[model samples]
Target chain A: DAGITQSPRYKITETGRQVTLMCHQTWSHSYMFWYRQDLGHGLRLIYYSAAADITDKGEVPDGYVVSRSKTENFPLTLESATRSQTSVYFCASFNRESYNSPLHFGNGTRLTVT
Target chain B: QKEVEQDPGPLSVPEGAIVSLNCTYSNSAFQYFMWYRQYSRKGPELLMYTYSSGNKEDGRFTAQVDKSSKYISLFIRDSQPSDSATYLCAMRDSFANAGGTSYGKLTFGQGTILTVHP
Candidate 1:
């Protein structure tokens, strides 16, 4: 009962539509991250939050946006979803205060933007 | 070049065989290393973790970090069919030495897909 969870385990949206993916973690970790995985590119970071109000871009943050208004929730929003954004999105969490902690991830959301 | 590079291997091996996977990084600032195993349509699971330049063995898996050469490796002995999945290598810096910038942020390599056949 104490793990990360993502809503709408599967989703499909039309191109240019606004879509938001939700991530909730019961562990109360201070650090949260979003990553996208494609056919051959593996997992690429989209955005990360160091705390409730501190967020930073990862390697592939151009098409994605994230906000952390609360510690338990970190949501990823695509202002205008495109077909290129149709991929699996994973949410992960870590404890910044714990030195060198491994990330705990959610089951992930399969978003297919047509 | 990617900061961390790993071969996108669809490495196939017979069950009970030993498996070796590796990744190399360009940033020597990395001091912590980790290996994650992910099955199809699932999130990655932390398999092994190592800090500093040495080898740490847990069960049938061994993780080795060679900071001197910026290389990291994972080995699975007597592999099982259930071990088929993607193995990703990730690294982060020791926060105390990151000039207050790094906060357990991980840089990951392109994962290698491994298939253990019966």
Candidate 2:
């Protein structure tokens, strides 16, 4: 498709296990972000990549790791998942070159850490 | 205290009623304001966007941003049953600073869930 795509729309994994969520965008945006949505907290940024091989921590990046090897791909990994990490993960991209452009989001991955 | 605060209302109203949603923020540096709508299991999509301060209207949806009061609002007129969803208010600072620090990040508010019944 022409929009962003997230893999594994739904996932369930045990605590302490490692899991990876994938995000890919066809627009080749310069900025890509990962956010986790939960009740009462809304959407908290986990990690963001400004460009390939450049990433930074966001509001809630303690247990999550992100890497962007290419401009179109930004994957989030939970090295040691916890029950608290059970929430929906969303990936978004933005073309910083344009001030009027808004972030384009994927449907999201529903992850359950049991 | 959070930077952005929203009512998180599970508001119910009859079809054709006027719907008003709002959010308050503590940051004055925020220059771009936005509203996003999310269905039951879908990611949020941008509904309205405004820069700095002022009101922007799009059909039945109107967005108002008042930087002086550090507040923003979204009003839906003649609401429909299909409008049932969660509305989120988000904003962020300028894209970059003098040093060229790109802050393309967004801070979101707790969403307000609304249902319009016929």
Candidate 3:
């Protein structure tokens, strides 16, 4: 209850269907991020939010959308899922005030697109 | 070349053996370095952190960063079976815009999987 949590630990969706991965943190960190992890690629950032209503793209933002309406929640969405998008998604957060603070991550949502 | 490179190793060793893990980066702008340990089906948690260059040790874990070579390393002494997990290296640039929004954004290397057999 005091840490980050992700819903739908595993998911399977058809190509072209929209799917949303949810992330919620109880720490109220100012910075939140979404990353996709795949074999050989490690983890690639999809999007990040500095604060509520402020979001920006990261290394791999194509085809994925993110929004942070509140400081405690950041959700990632695939407008139209593609087979290539099948990967484990992770959400992370950190207190921006502390430059050296490492990110605290959620358990992650495993999304499989077929 | 990718900004960060790490071997996705399934490195296996017997318990009590010293373990070495490393990562190299191509970005000269990166100033902060970190190592994370991830257990099966769990999110990664910070294991070691170093800023810029030099070495820092905590418990049986030591972190080394060489800015000149753009390399970083994590070493574990007298490893235990519980140390078996994936290790990820991450870095972030020092440059932040006037808004100070991108300072926390990190670039990660492919994780190295290590198993310490008991």
The C-alpha lDDT values of all candidates are 0.91, 0.93, 0.92
Clashing pairs for model 3 are none
Residue A13 shift from truth in candidate 3, angstroms: 1.0
Error of 1 at A12 (Å): 0.8
Best by DockQ: 3
Docking class of 1: medium
Residue-level lDDT of model 3, residues B1-118, one tens digit each, is 8899999998999999999999999988898999999998888999998889999999999999999999999999999999999999999887463246776888899999999999
DockQ of each: 0.70, 0.76, 0.80
Superposed Cα RMSD, model 2? 1.1
In candidate 1, the residue pairs with backbone N, CA or C atoms under 3 Å apart (3 or more residues apart, or in different chains) clash, namely none
True interface contacts reproduced by each model, as a fraction? Answer: 0.63, 0.68, 0.84
True-contact fraction in model 1 equals: 0.63
Identify the superior model by lDDT, candidate 1 or candidate 2: 2
Error of 2 at B117 (Å): 0.9
How should the candidates be ordered by lDDT, best one leading? 2, 3, 1
- Report residue B116 deviation for candidate 2 (angstroms): 1.0
lDDT score, candidate 1, position B49:
88
Candidate 2's displacement at residue A65, Å, is 1.0
Name the runs in model 1 displaced over 4 angstroms.
Answer: B99-101
